[model samples]
Target chain A: DQQVKQNSPSLSVQEGRISILNCDYTNSMFDYFLWYKKYPAEGPTFLISISSIKDKNEDGRFTVFLNKSAKHLSLHIVPSQPGDSAVYFCAALVSGNTPLVFGKGTRLSVIA
Target chain B: EAGVAQSPRYKIIEKRQSVAFWCNPISGHATLYWYQQILGQGPKLLIQFQNNGVVDDSQLPKDRFSAERLKGVDSTLKIQPAKLEDSAVYLCASSDGKDSFQETQYFGPGTRLLVL
Candidate 1:
């Protein structure tokens, strides 16, 4: 079973526009959520993360919104840049010692 | 500081052959992990190590796959008698603390393996 799900396979946004990516989870026990970006042939890099305690967290141009009641989360990048084009994956930690479970990634393309 | 390092960026082998990948984590990191990323899929954790001892390997195919961290610094992953479905990218990640629940993992570029 897919514990985490990213329904959108790809998303396209124009430069200087807002790019929003969404994710959902079936397990309410997950306490920490993370987002990672990956380029072709490269491993994933950390983007932003949010804890179950908070509803929202913002860093610079990126923002993550978590809704515990719905078991859903989203990542928003304001003024998307062409350089931001890459695959994004949403991950969740199962417990204190368990490895993180990842969702099928969504590829984002920003056009100039 | 340097990020995680992986060797043999690309490897091609026939089915039933043996292949190995090596990784050198960021200096002073205490936790190490190996992951498998198939095409169009998110990465899956295969194993995790705290120092030279294993913390988790339940998802690992222990019958044909093996990993070791000799001195709690560097690590190696190997697959013997490989199968065609084994084609995937192997990623190595390291964190500064033993508690992965609270720490960030730094990832390496990864090693791509193709089995014929």
Candidate 2:
């Protein structure tokens, strides 16, 4: 079973606008959540992460918000740029010692 | 510092043939992991190791798959009598320690295997 799910397969947004990607998980044991960005034919690169203790974490123009009660999280990018176009994956981990469970991923297209 | 390294970026073979992929983690990183990603799907963990010892392999198919990490550094994954469903990109990643809750993992480009 897929513990993490990204309902949207793809998303499109115009440049200089906010792009929101959503993810949900069924396992409450997961305490750490992360987002990774991947380009075609390349490995995934870590973007940002948030601990379950906090409801939100921000890094530069990227922000991650977590709702433990709902078992959901979202990533928001402000003033999205064309360079932001890529596949975004959401992952969750029970701890540093365990392997991460990933969502199917969402393809984000930022139009110029 | 160099990131994780993988060999044989692409491979194609007939079904029931044998194939192997290699991976070298970042220097001084003790935790290594292998993952398989199918088209339009998230990556699935195949195996994990901590300093030459296996931490998890619950998802691995023992009948056809085997993996090893020698000297606590590099690793190899082998599939004997590969099946058509085994066609996917094999990814390697590494972290400084087993507890990666706070540490960032580095991933290699991955080896794309196509089984006909």
Candidate 3:
């Protein structure tokens, strides 16, 4: 059974627009969540993260929001640039100390 | 501040052959993890090491897959009599091992394996 799920497989957005990627989880014990961005032929790199204690966390153009009660989280990127075109994986862990469980990933393409 | 390092970027072998992959984690990092990522799927945990000790290997197929990190600084994964299903990208990652829940893991470029 997949503990985490990314319903959307791919999304496209024009430059200077906002792109949102959503994720849902079935495990309620997961308290820490993270987003990783991966380029072709490279490993996934850390993007942003949010804990269940907080509803939101932001860094530069990237923002992550968590709705613990609903077991959902979303990553928001404002003024999306072409460089943001890649696969995004949503991951979560239980008790803040377990190995991450990752979703299939969402491919986002930002057009110029 | 060096990231994780993996060797044999690409490997191809016929069924029943043996293969091995190596990994070197970041300097001073105490935690190491190995993952297998099949095409069109997310990476899955294969094994986890904490300073030369095996912390988790539940997902590993011990009958054909085995891993060791004797020195705690580096690790190697070996598969004997490989099968076609063993084809996948093997990724090695590491973290500082200080934070309980907020630590960030750095991943290596990964070694792509193809079993013919």
| Candidate closest to the true structure, highest DockQ | 3
Better of 1 and 3 by lDDT: 1
- Whole-model Cα lDDT of every candidate shown, in order: 0.94, 0.94, 0.93
Where does candidate 2 stray beyond 4 Å? Answer: B98-101
What is each candidate's fraction of native interface contacts (fnat)? 0.75, 0.73, 0.71
TM-score of each: 0.98, 0.97, 0.98
**TM-score of chain A, all candidates:** 0.98, 0.98, 0.98
Candidate 3 on B78-99: residue-level lDDT in tens? 9998999999999999988888
Over A9-108, each residue of candidate 3 has an lDDT whose tens digit, in order, gives 9999999999999999999988889999999888889899888899999999999999988999999999899999999999998754568889999999
Better of 1 and 3 by DockQ: 3
Tens-place lDDT per residue, model 2, A1-112, is 8899999999999999999999999999999999999898888889999999999999999999999999999999998999999999999988757888899999999999
RMSD of each candidate? 1.0, 1.1, 0.9
**Per-residue accuracy of model 1 over B1-116 as CA lDDT, tens digit each:** 99999998999999999999999999999899999999988899999999999999999999999999999999999999899999999999998876656777889999999999
